[model samples]
Target: MEIISKLSILIVILFISCHSGRGNVDVQQSADSIAVCHIGAIPSRFTALHKDTLSYEKGEDNVRMVFIRGGKFKMGSTDFVDAQPVHAVEVNSFYMDEHEVTNAQFEAFVKATDYVTVAERPLDPKEFPGVDPAMLVPGSAVFTNPSKVDGMDNFLQWWQYVPGANWRYPEGPNSSIRGKEDHPVTQLAYEDAEAYAKWAGKRLPTEAEWEYAAKAGNHTSETYYWGSEKKENGKWLANIFQGDFPMKNTKEDGFETTSPVKSFPANAYGLYDMEGNVWEWCSDFYRPDYYMQSPKSNPKGPSSSHDPQEPGLVKRVQRGGSFLCNDEYCERYKAGSRGKGEVNSPTNNVGFRCVKDI
Candidate 1:
């Protein structure tokens, strides 16, 4: 496989958290202050939903959503080549999930549809013509830490393709999500996320929509969802790596892997895990230079995917950072940073939430 292809596979596996500091407050206390609106119980019109608080929920699983009253904002950043050429863009108002889709919520969808995720299917030999059929077993990528590594370039050093690894078995066949139903669902490919969205009567957010909501109507150029600072008054606002990447995790955020949804305080618009939890799949195709040709109002992403590093493979945009993100290496936890993965590749670290048109 090409380097980019390898990187995409590794991205899925590396998906992998924090704590009290100055101005420390209990998480439960913070949640109690925010009002949660339930879907179906609230007005069906977008304007009505927008008038209420920015958060909503529905179904037995309580799929929470937050309304984003969108407008013009600068998209992209100059810090990275792909995020370069920052430009102004506008998006209409919409409702977004308050947190990443939880395992319980996805389970409800699967039970209703009897759906099987892409990760559960065996690989097709035609896709890898020269590969031995023996290696084509069904599986998804899972993260494993080596004692040490030379550098981040060799992703295979930390990522392993384990048979029987899927959403329910995030680590592999031996692992299970028995008590982690509230945690974000993982090992999901792009199609898997889209399938759940369709079943829930929602859709994945566009890159522009995701970015706009992440900004939370701030409109000002900022590095994080909360503000320019990564932490607030010494408190770790989001779940992200606190120690060495792919080796040691300090667990300062009270979680070493995926935490339950709403473990941290929500953003200004009441969206949780917008910075770090799992990288979310966007509706648009990936393109490094899409910002240059992006529209001023409600820009969807590029018409088709294109990654110069691996042009042959189709990819989609993955926003937000994940639990594995760290400042030393994968600084993607930053709000404006961007990531991409192959459409069919699934990993323990990759998951998604949904959005409604209203």
Candidate 2:
């Protein structure tokens, strides 16, 4: 079935019938001479699994939305090697969160709504009884220097899996969100973000809307959300790694960790942290070649597929860049350079905002 670009709101329920499977797979050159799997393989069992149901229930409280006018713009990148073959895309008007969900907001949602984050819970033993206890620890990704590096790259050197580092405890067991309410909440999985959106009468923006908003009407191809220039008047526009990634960060932005959502200037649309801070989650399943087949109007994503590159068969899209991003490696600050992450995966540098139909 060909994926259609319609304005009608639908509840997309991802159905996993079988756990073991492989779709269209291709070997592509990744950074540091590593050939990784580029997962965009359309499955043969493609069918209308289910439509997206109502996002928000009735009578949700304390939810805010930012009105975004829809328009036509180039969706992909022409500069990045992976973001090749830019294409035109059109979308309808929608409402999105003013900023990435903050710690205060997330705490309020959990306290009032009695929501339990995925990381806080334990894995179902029936699914994988032989799972390692260490791997199943309740936690999310944390940014920490490796104890001993055996020449693996800088990006790998900085990311560590700290136990008890979920949304409540951002920096593992020892750290907490106390006194840091304004900071954008990290260590949230895609499921956690979706739950909050549903509780707040909103939904996560599709990858298309996220990119369009980042563009902010700049028809010219640019590297960052702000502009082609790296800085403005000798000032850093966004929070990124400097003075060598992983090993040494000068904290040039006056932050060793996450900064406030609006610490940097807004894009042309007045949206802050659209390029820096933390990566935002989108509703689309990542496909590097989706631009080639995506509809010119309101494109969602591929009909169905399995990304072999990921640890398992999870489908989702990650947008914007995180604080760990630098020019030396993982130059994903560009609006078009896409990062493919699993739907259930959680990391310290990954957070999400919300969106709704206008």
Candidate 3:
């Protein structure tokens, strides 16, 4: 309901795109027209192919996972202030989803449990003391970029709350996910993600587990999961915005919004969509200075949450970037960069994968 004021300041300005009423159609066309040379599938010779590594599938959902061997690696980054103090962290072997959860998978869970996402529920009057009861309608934040804008200070210019906007109707009541079941499910609040994870007998990854898995045990201060370079021989490795932020997307990666998971190459650990597509939910609470006191082995993130920009709200860690991320404005697609979102606020650019501890 009334999704404004529910987002963190950074999330508010993180990413936006131009909306042309039929925006999704035009963007999808642009993506389809791009002549991208696809990379070959993961090779069997990779290190993750060990016999001890586990892979599993369950139910009609058919979610697949890859075994990530535990090891010590230097986490965080020197480039961003929040990811500073590059510290050492080690995680035990765990099974991680090969791709982000898809709409088909989420639909299966919802059908089995009749689960209602937070965005689908009515807004409690007690949560907003002074707001008019008439304005408190169930809804979620949807991206709606203007054709052009003068400044970025006002986030409401690009994001709006529309009733009937949920994972099924990402853009609003008018949009549908009919042919896009393979695409990553969006408009999920933290509780929605957690609920899905629990039903699937998995849990959201810790900040440490996420970083370690992304690094794929080949950590060397690389800017991206594949390597230090954003582009490999003039090829896009992830689905990030390729043009002006909040104005245009070149669709160089064959996606205008969320791509079908694994549309691009997987990381060294055989994980897909690790760097871009959508910001993924992490189990840990958010704290800018948590790295300073993080434990050497298996750091699970801060015990409590804190964001100076929005002190009253509880925030959780959101890893990777989204299709809206561009180097010109938001360079969050780089490895070790950090993002946070209010636990109850579901935006179009956020989704999540799950992990199971061995």
Off by over 4 Å in 2: 1-64, 127-135, 153-156
Total colliding residue pairs, candidate 1: 6
Clashing pairs in model 1?
15-349, 16-323, 18-252, 18-253, 18-254, 19-252
Candidate 1 stretches greater than 4 Å from native: 1-62, 128-132
Instruction: List model 1 lDDT by residue over 294-328, tens digit each.
Output: 88998888889876645556678888878877666
Local error of candidate 2 at 207, Å? Answer: 1.1
TM for every model, in the order presented, reads 0.81, 0.81, 0.83
Question: Lowest summed-lDDT stretch of 10 residues in model 3?
Answer: 35-44
Q: lDDT scores for all predictions?
A: 0.70, 0.65, 0.72
Please give, for residues 1-358, the per-residue lDDT of candidate 2 as tens digits. Answer: 1111110001011211101111222323222232111111111112211122234343353545667899998877665544556788899999877788899888887776566665566544344345444344455556675545555323334454455768878878898888888889987766778877777777888888998888878888666777777688887898877765556778887777788878888877778888878888888876555666789999888776444433345667777877876766556766677766655556677788988897
From the highest TM-score down, the ranking of the candidates is 3, 1, 2
lDDT of 1: 0.70
For each candidate, C-alpha RMSD in Å? Answer: 12.4, 9.9, 12.0
